[model samples]
Target: MLANPATALELDHVSRHFDGRAVLSDISLSIPAGKITCLLGQSGCGKSTLLRIISGVDRPDPGGRVLVGGTEVAGPGRFVEPEDRRIGFMFQDYALFPHLSVADNLAFGLRHLSRPERRERVAKVVERIGLGHLLDRYPHSLSGGEQQRVALARALAPRPSILLMDEPFSNLDQGLRERVRRETVDILRETGTTAIMVTHDPQEALAVGDMIVLMRAGRIEQVGTPFEIYDRPCSAYAAEFMGPCNRLTGLWSQGRIETPIGAFRADLDMPDGALALACIRPQALSIGPDGQGISARVMAKTFTGESEQIDIMVHPLAQTLRMHSHVRIPMGIGDKVSLQLNGAQVHVFPEEPGTDDPLDQS
Candidate 1:
């Protein structure tokens, strides 16, 4: 299939309200052409709602605008229907027609074209997606992954400018989900399709997205490449949302924050003697020889195939600290070990008011 010229998407203060409550608030984002941009956040963070507004499935509130390829699709006194916007939408369920065969389903959107043109379009998409063998099969006869590919082919058959996927791989099992998700990303890249995918999984966003837009409670929390969002989160909420972190409450003093483990350099702006929170990822902690760092006793160990998660009870803190080790540690439960922190991975942020313990939030 010939690659469609990718179109960039722009949202200008796009806000959506329902029954006097705001679902999306002041969302202004510029999605680059021919790249996968993942809309990442927890459930009800307005990721899907924002996608709907951009696709013309729903409308934004007054004064908000949505532009596609430098043309306003939705704004004050101007609105384009979803079909007229030339956008392809792949739903969470794949949404393949139950009665139609694979080939017919792929050609469903090409009804306006001549019969030969529709057949040629479907053939091109099927060949590109390697779905030729399943052309005669029905939706009920296909596996989850096959159904997903069919839905993708159907969406791409019309050669839309941009593709919008909402939790595309949520239906597949863990193993199949990983493989299918990778294949889907490869196809998108191969076709040079500009895509905006909504997913609640941080790992999915980190793995497949060229750019990640982290959303929170109807607002964009952070936007950057996967590394930036993971390494240099803008806030405590952003830090924890991307991955699990061992949060510690401490007092900022003399350009450093003193915690239960030790004093870490405070890179954030905080007044002297003010409360701050330190976010340390499990991968940042390592096991070293006794007396080299803070003393801790191994409370539990979980083997996760790629790495072993060790829970250690620190003397200064009431809760246990979790650490991930790729190499098998010659340590057992109740064994005393020294825990060393990688200073580069320790992030400090101003503590949220009314929260005594940073770990207690959420």
Candidate 2:
């Protein structure tokens, strides 16, 4: 864990509600300075609500504390207005003023500065965002990517201490989104700005963020680096949500887990005959002849030039297990293939209540 004592933003037991419905529930996390943190979750998971609270666009319950630069911004009947919080927000819709030209939009928040200072700030931001040529153009005349840059430039025009982004890349196409997000990350790092972005795209969160936060329901499930989360997920939900994983229910037997696929060893403490769930990454799987391992029929295959997605039917054990391989194996539908499970360590989770007993081998 990268622990920095100099945190730029801190949320202590934050919670929010909308018309009696809870949106954020007891959220707590500290965002370190000069680091990019991505809040990742599905729609309506309260990641955006947390962002709003941090930006002071929305207030948290009186029991929670919102701190920035070691000062309390919101706590126990106290609230700081959004504009006074020294936080910049990049909305999902870009939020560029339709009537204002790019230059004026970028200069909107600079009323406190002299005309020369405003011109200098806007010029610097426009040049950095690569929108120098489109400064005089209206929002309708600019491309999506250009408008996104303008919005970013406007937020950055005032040199905020913290920056918040709400799905800023969702408006762009897949390829363009990747490119723009990469550029935005580079800019943020170059400026050494502390930022927290809300996004549902796991890949984008992993690719762009220094730290990834996984959220479920209205609370944070886990937080770690991309490599840490991908390789050693804290739970089955975290593993499955971050990417594809084969979850198989099994029983612990003699230092190995006995599943329908076969007995496999794992570095976990499970008593003999204990019911457990094993999560295996697709990349860790290899297939050959079924006679050597657990027999599984080839369910389906989809080739994507670089890799092939092979779905094998591990009957009575799981609905199906999907695996990816670089080489195209010479097999057809209904063919049986042996399974080989190879990885550093597999995550074994305890079975939840009311689930079928994994020890029942009937």
Best model per lDDT: 1
Over the stretch 1-362, how does candidate 1's per-residue lDDT look in tens digits?
22223548889999999999999999999899999999998887899999999899899999999888888899999999999998999999999999999988998999999999998899899899999999999999999999999999998889988899999999999999999999999999999998999998889999999999998879999999999999999988888888889988999998899998989996666789999989899988998767878898899999999999999999879999999999999999888999898988888998886533212324
- Candidate 2 residues lying further than 4 Å off, grouped into runs, are 1-5, 254-256, 264-271, 289-293, 315-318, 353-362
Off by over 4 Å in 1: 1-7, 354-362
Best by TM-score: 1
TM-score result, candidate 2: 0.91
Which lDDT tens digits does candidate 2 get at residues 12-109?
A: 99999889888889999989898999999877788988988898888897799998888888999789999899999999999999999988999999
Give all TM-scores, in the order shown: 0.95, 0.91
lDDT of each: 0.90, 0.85
Relative to the true structure, candidate 1 reaches a TM of: 0.95
Model 1, residue 351: displacement in angstroms?
Answer: 0.4
Q: What is the C-alpha RMSD of each candidate to the true structure, in Å?
A: 3.3, 4.6
Compared with the true structure, the alpha-carbon lDDT of candidate 2 equals 0.85
The window of 10 residues in a row where model 1 has the poorest summed lDDT is 353-362
